[model samples]
Target: MSTQPAPASRPFSIMPPPPPPVPLPVRARSFALVGTFTASVFLSAFLLFLVQPMFGKMVLPLLGGSPAVWNTCMLFFQAALLGGYLYAHLSTQKLGVRAQVGLHVGLLAVTALLLPISVAGRSPEGSDAPIPWLLGTMLLTVGPPFFVLAGTGPLLQRWFAHSGHRNAADPYPLYAASNLGSMLSLFAYPALMEPRMRLAGQSAAWAMGFGALALLIAGAAAWVWRPVPPSAERADAVPADAPALSHSRTSVPWRERGIWTFLAFVPSAMLLALTTYITTDLSPVPLLWVLPLALYLLTFTLAFARRPPLPHEHMLWLQPPVLMVVVLLLLSGFVEEAVAAIPVHLAGLFVTGMVCHGELARRRPAVRHLTEFYLWISVGGVLGGIFNVLVAPVVFNNVYEYALSIGLACLARPWPQERRGWRGQAMMAVRTVAVTAALLYIGANSKDMNPGLLMASAAALMLLLTLALARTPLWLALCLGTVMMYSTVKAIREPGVLLAERSFYGRFKVVEFGIIERFHVLRHGSTLHGAQSLRNPRDPITYYLPHGPVGQIFAATAPRAGRRKVAVVGLGTGTTAAYARAGEEWTFYEIDPHVVRMATDRRYFTYLPDSPAKTRIELGDARLSLARASEPKYDMIVLDAFSSDAIPVHLLTREAMGTYLDRLAPGGVIAIHISNRYLDLEPVVAALVRERGLAARVSSGPDGKRKRYESIATWITVARTEEDLVIVAADRRWKPLTDRRVPPWTDDYSSLLSVFEW
Candidate 1:
């Protein structure tokens, strides 16, 4: 009631009720812009990722379980991705927003006709190369669909930029979300889809998801029909490198494009190299493949964020040290130990990938140049894949590509370009010479020194070198020389070594190691293929020892009445041939011809030459060779083919088993060498046995038993009838294989994920 109270009421509100809660139509448009585009990208990425592992599993049996199969698959995928990015770039530039929408939608509709993917054939017929055949098969089955899916990421990101949203200044964050979808699909495949469904069912589900993606894409296209305001279009026209908008209309510099290509190439090549190292040298389980790839994708997700959680400069600093650790691991011989090797490899992949991808994100062009950026990155990816898959195998005898890639990654660092003063130059020279001297000293004294001590010293020396030369361009050349010198010293020569051969299949070393009595050990990577006693040339000393299941197999079958025919799938040191008797017909089917030469050589193995039976060697992939060969019912067929520690998955499929059954004489038994440090192969054999109505028994070596030049062996014997299995099954050492319910491996589907030990 007082005048003072009236004066207090005058200062009511300068805020004006918070601007009317944003007009409904405006709010609706913004929501639609983000929601529709993000959904489209996420679903498209999921489908893309889901199909990779699914189709990889589908084709794995066709080519056997070589890690190279994944490499080839990656090559195809990268090519497809490049094609997609190219299409996106051209289409976006040539077409208006609505026309772009119409074109892609029409293409998607057309591609939908090829949905519900299925493998075309089991494998190529006679005279066909497996890698090319596999590539052709992939192209026929999933190529068009994958290409279409891959294009959606950049295309939809471009669409969102023109949708009149306030956050239109940036579209790269959507890329992070896209990668999240990719990462999720990778996790979902092994964790849910693989374990629960067969390949056919998974394909069906993927097709359904594709259809949903099509609908979401259609919804996103609706935004193109609406009018975008001038201000919003201007938002997307902002320069990628701010404070420098003068060249907005000009083409990006060639140097910047080259930087993008280089940044992308390092990570892409590193991914495949690390995957191969883990699968071929560590463990060939498909899950091991998932880890490196998942980390690789996750780096993209972390890097391209609007505000990256981890800084690019930090990765730049962290990468060199981690790279040094990786190089040291490669040289230390711990690569043979899975427990020690796997973590180091995966960690190196993640850090180096972070550095490369982080640089990519930092230098990303404007929204106006989004497709151009993506196109260059994809080209880099395809080139990297080609180098690893095609070029490296032909150029290098060993897996030198992995080491070479590590050095290239070091070169990718943003080294200081300014001229250093004399003091700084002198310091750099000193550091480089010191590193070179230390590595050369280690290499020279590697044989005489304690390997552990030398390895530790090398690691310490590398750490110091990394710290000193981190900002210098000379790190690349120095690191490469260190690797080459170290590898040459350690791997090329050994005391009492007979010979070493490296093929695309793997490295094979025939070394003589024994204190009192010399034994010739045939080693593939770290696993013993066979060992022959020089004291008794005919004596099979390793897994094929006289008391092992291989000896039992020949004891029962080699003595069969008539002209006995025996088939061995893997010709490891030809040790199984030692069990042969006079007039026995023995044929070894070996995937690696080098293995055949080495095993047949009287100087190295002599198991084949020393055997009393007549032996013939068939050189080619075991399954393909067997499939093409004339029908000859054998008394006993042995499945013992292995690459590194991994059994070729194709050799264990029902189709492969059928091939074996077709080749076997009535009542003949199949002896499978299932001994592995990482896989429970008995279960695989048991599942196949149960599904085929066959009887099987497992012979396991004594727990914790160690013998001279010998290893613990586990053999699974399978036959059409229980009586046929009697010879090995009746022995107390051999017991009935576990009959646990597990899926039978097929050409269409299999999951070693379930059977992996760790």
Candidate 2:
């Protein structure tokens, strides 16, 4: 028998009886498969998020650096993401696995032609519909590529579930990886990429990354490719006792999908609402929008993680108190500083996101319905964006969407499955009504009371009510809704508020506030943009007061001869026109048409009409409009543009300085109003002036002891020669801007974080 066996094996002797083939360890193979899918998903998310701020920055100057640019971009992205998820769901359900992979790869290849990304068109000239224009521009510029990228996470994870891996039964952890990539990218762009690379370089690098991702995606497709059906592959790879697979055969109900949507909606809405609230009301830092988004993505990461750092129950426990604290902050005017407000608002958002997204994760469907699950979640995200960007601006004034989302999040919290009896429900209803009445009463009566005392009392009562109702999500939501309603009503009924309007740029309020003399104040968030005296209608008050830095700038820059021509970048209440002399020409460049309307409306302000000079308003982004201006025509160029309290960073960069120099008349001076409550812009201006080989003087205007109407201001005047700025330089109050050795901001690279007062 041995001789027979040896004779039979003699055919292999030439190959020396090749050693038995070694098989990879099961655990090693499983990890390798999981990592490939995870990394593909991660790269998809990283590229998706990196493009947001990079492209937003590219388009920021077109929109005058309005924080709304970022909001609108978020909306666009959400909508695109929805479209992508829809495609993923339909394709996966309707097509074979190979067909799905082929279609997606083809789409990716096509979208590659659109990169490196850019803003497609100049914002339509004098276009009144900035939101529509921005949406259109973004759609044309990056829509295809972004939509392709947005779908990669869901599609790849779905593929992974069918990939015949041991852990294929549960692929949700890959979603955590996806969002982790998003969070890291958002942080990296601002801290590393932005400071080091110009926008152009970032775009190019992003394009190359996309190419690598495409190859990796192909590799993933190859790894999962099978001649057998996906069902057969899963049957061969996974065990019968796999927990996730037990529910894989069940169909998700419409009701379950609706719950998934609602759970996703609150956090999605809160992301944009919180971003708008922070950048609009607190600080308009250059990359400020990234924080809300990163936190938003982080919640997704934690909620879906295999082993979350923060437990789901813990998040639920933390949510109510955080919401109550946020409500108190909203009612009270405390925490106005960005350093404090940012963390407070971000914490609220994080907790709310945790509760909502954690619920979504808990209720996540089996691997078979993964694509459908993502589709519904994306629907909620898009709806949230629409509510904040489209619906809120139309339905309610200010950022009530933020408060509304908070209430919705309250409702999304896990509720008792058992229904309460009629008596219990009635009692809960009565208690809610009583709480509502009390909150409304306190808010209505707040005007005459000491504001701090009133806010304290109301906040205390609301906190107590919320804590009591925390066990019942429905009742807690009702109480939170009541609190928000009271806050909104109080704001609407606030004393001296004449007109409150919202635009794509920001919220604008015209109010009459004065004891001895009435003044019409144009307010943007907490910042006083400009004010006009009803007693002396032609006088420039607020930041433009006769004794303020702006006033000093006007006095120093006035031409000695006839027919001086001037250009003002920002047209806030047209206040700079107050210094105009007869026979002079003044052109105002304003980004928001609403601002132009408010400034020209005699009922609110009269600076432009009352000016003795010939005044004309130019409606567009100042940078774009100035690029079209007649070179060297302006005797003086005044940069007074602001997006709420923060000046548009583009206006303070070296490139902007060069534009001003190009537009300057011989011996002309560039006067920049650098006043800000949150940023140290003097250093930024000093850097710009030094880079341009120009002389400059900076003035921190009169002290707080000055006239009530004279708001403290800071201004910097830059000139080609010292003689051009001699008048300002001679004044002790206006000191030469010594180089602070700060890096000069360029169009390609600028970080508000670098210049942030914090």
Candidate 3:
């Protein structure tokens, strides 16, 4: 009994001993391999997205700050991405693993030579085809580097799959990692990088990152390379759940590839269409461009995640309701304020993108066809960019492409797997027509009915129709299409619009308003650019009304010497020309040709023709046009470009201030119209002025209660010294800016967040 008790002695610890440590060599090798590939991919994507906004910012000064500039940049990026995907597909298909590694490593080294990207050439002067010019310039600037980086995602994942690792069977999670990098870069640019760093600093840092990425890529290549036969490697890499066909030998069906492309197209198009719609229809909030693109990249991360938190089925079920709410908001015109409209539209875009991209993840082909799958997806993205950038502007007068894309996204939603009988189809058709007809009735009688009641009725009908046709994608698409058509048509054909034109710059309309006074207004989006009295065309109205801040600026700066010369950066209806006096010379720099045409048409505006000064119009971006000017100096420079609310950031940087100072005559003043609904630009201008050791005075006009045509305005006048601004500084309404410091914006860096009103 004593011996038995001795045998039952307890162990020293409760826990079992740890298994033998992974062999140090094996552990280090594995860690190095996995870490190298992941870091390389992450760095590549980070560099890829960072270059977009960086290069876009550089290009904006050449082109005016039209939202189209971003859209055009997106087109170029997509096209380059497509080319990269094609290269990846072909190279992987034709070459062995070792050969692929050598080829890719060489590519990274070559692309490194083009590091620290910058715009290559000046925009052609007076070129009507800015799109081509922009695309060509970008091609020379960032194309090779972007193309190589774009291929890193698929290429690295393919390499990892053949590495003979335990987790090689399923390599899709790396795609989520890739997109994660992209999303972070987008957020970082606006939040951290732009606010803290200069453009030159950012570029240098990006170049350093590229160098590190090349080294990482070389490590990944060395880890994956093998002397074994290609067939043996492919056989070893085949996943247990994958089909028997070797990825190397198998050919994906064209129909499947097409399905992949169609799934990808809707979301890609929606990304741009929604961005344009938001910036065009709502407030052009600073850095708002990133929100849509960030959401766009986020969908890819979620869709390809190892375990998606929100399942594809959930997005499918959730999209219709969100889409219906967006339709209601658009139709009712209730959510006009940027605070409300922005979140609503952004949510809609996120949900819609999730559905499309989720479907893409679900349908992704075997590892063997990975590059091909990405190639088709890239094709879809390029097509989307082309549609929105090139085709939509010519085909539709308004932002009709945005609505069209929404309808198309509805069609892209998963249809019922079970075929519908004729009775089911007939029922769907009946419900669609009923909802569409009700919408039409509401639109037709909108003026006669109380807006709230009409909106309520339309919302109820749309909700009912959405639920009724939830299982039928085609009918749901048709109903939404009808709603969009009617709503947009009504908005476009408002009673007062005499002329409506669309260009890459923006939508422009000459709207007749004020029955008693009879005025024609030049409107861009929701902001009034300039307006003229039909009875007295030479009288400035709206933001430039006599007695307003701008009027005060002109009065204060009126020439006391012989033949003063004036330069106007933006020529909205040429309203500032009304301030010109006899023997004075005026030059107007206008970016949009359409605006120039309307301003000079005498029928719509006579401010320039009626002015007594020797006035001339120059068509181009203001900064570039001004740089090319032969004039030695300008007595007064007026900045009137901010009224449309898309503040051309390039025009407000410290370098821009230097340009203005260079062109300014001794004792000359610079007048900037800073009246804005969303941005407190006086602070920005003040910061710039103080940075240059200049004096500035700000005029905040009264509420214009005395005249219907006059509008409340704000203008800031800057000069080399306080004495130069004495004329405005003496007025009670014009306050001298304090020397309090805020971060000054330079050519390398600017943050809309710094000056955002809210």
TM-scores of the models, in the given order? 0.89, 0.86, 0.88
lDDT of 3 by residue, 1-758 (tens): 01110111111112223222111111223766778878888888988888888888877767655556777787788878888899899998899777888888888888777777876457656657787888888887789889989988889988887776556645777888898899999888877777777777888888898998888888888878744334335522333322222232346667767778888889888888888777766766656778898899899999888688887777876787678767766776643577877888888888988998877775565567778878898888888888888888888778878888889888887666467799978988898898777766765565578868976876686577657876678888898788888888788868988888888788878988886779888878767787888878778777787777888877777655338898999988888887788888888988788888898888788888788889888877788767767675999999988535855877898878888888999999998888887877777888998777999888777653757657888888999998898888998889877544668876667887767778
Instruction: Please give, for residues 435-530, the per-residue lDDT of candidate 1 as tens digits.
Output: 767765665565578878977886787678667777775654575557656775666665877887677777667888888888888777666788
Candidate 1 error regions (>4 Å): 1-32, 60-71, 120-125, 129-137, 234-236, 239-249, 283-286, 421-423, 435-467, 476-484, 494-497, 628-630, 702-706
Best-fitting candidate, measured by lDDT? 2
| lDDT score, candidate 2 | 0.78
Query: Residue 683 CA error for candidate 1 (Å)?
Result: 2.1
Q: Write the per-residue lDDT of candidate 2 for residues 353-377, one digit (tens) a residue.
A: 9888877776665566888889999
Instruction: For model 1, name the residue pairs that clash.
Output: none
| Global fold similarity of model 1 (TM-score) | 0.89
Error of 1 at 565 (Å): 0.9
Model 3 vs. true fold: TM: 0.88
- Ten contiguous residues with the weakest lDDT in model 2: 1-10
- Residue 285, model 1: lDDT of 57
Q: Weakest 10 consecutive residues, lDDT, candidate 1?
A: 1-10
- Candidate that beats the other on lDDT, 1 or 3, i.e. the better one: 3
